[model samples]
Structures are given as structure tokens and as C-alpha cells.
Target: MTHRVSELTVAESAWCKSSYSSGEGGECVEVATCAAAVLVRDSKRPTEARLCFAPEAWAGFLQMTTGH
Candidate 1:
């Protein structure tokens, strides 16, 4: 199965760095949520490519990672 994710500009999305990231960056990630999908990108490389996750999948991943 194939899923489609809309490519969005940084300004277009309300991007926020993960709270888990520290000032001294080491493997940091940023995320933004939209109507269609959740956007994720490397905090260190703001201009790089982004990975999109479907809303349901994103929520499931979060729940699993956080052990909720």
C-alpha cells in the first residue's frame, strides 16, 4: 500500500524541536503536525529532507516509544 504526504515548507508548518533535545545537540529531531500527516526532520539539518508519518501511525509510534 502507498500513502501520500504533502511536502511543506518550514514556515508553512508550525515546527517545534523535541523537548527531549538539549541545547548541546546530539541526534535531535523536530516535528510538526498537520491535518494530513505528521512531519519529522533533523533538527541539526533544518534544510534537509523530512519524513512524513500518517496520523494514526505517528500516534501509535508515540505510544509505543513512550510506553503509554
Candidate 2:
């Protein structure tokens, strides 16, 4: 399925960044949780880039990243 992140209302979504996100916000990324999906976006460019993934996929990514 084709995922068009820009189609979604990112501003309305509550995006949260990883604790590991750097203070510079240059390489930092933010995440937003939704009922059907999770959104990953760049903190530096909130409206520029975004990636929307299924909840399960996002959870898997988070688990792999957090290593819990």
C-alpha cells in the first residue's frame, strides 16, 4: 500500500520524540501515535518529512530500537 504521509494532518497529531533525541534537533526525530498508525517525522522539519507506519510495524520498530 502506498503511504502518503503529507496527506495526514501532522500538526493536529501529538508528536513525541525519542528520549535519545539530541538537543540540537538536527538529527532528532519525532513520533506521533494514532489509533490506526504511528507517525515518524523529523524534528527539525516537522512539515517537511514524515513516515507513516502501521501500529504493529511501529511497535516492532520501537521494540527493536529501545531493545527492551
Candidate with the greatest TM-score versus the true structure = 1
For each candidate in the order shown, give its overall lDDT on alpha carbons: 0.78, 0.75
Q: Give per-model TM-scores.
A: 0.79, 0.73
What are the RMSDs of all candidates, in order? 2.5, 2.4
In model 1, where do residues sit more than 4 Å from their true spots? 1-6, 9-13
Question: What tens-digit string does per-residue lDDT give for candidate 1 at 1-68?
Answer: 33444444446458888898877968889898877778898988977778988789999999999999
Mind giving the per-residue lDDT tens digits that candidate 2 earns over 1-68?
A: 55566656655548888688667745887888766668887787877767889888877987998897
Cα deviation of 64 in candidate 1 (Å)?
Answer: 0.5
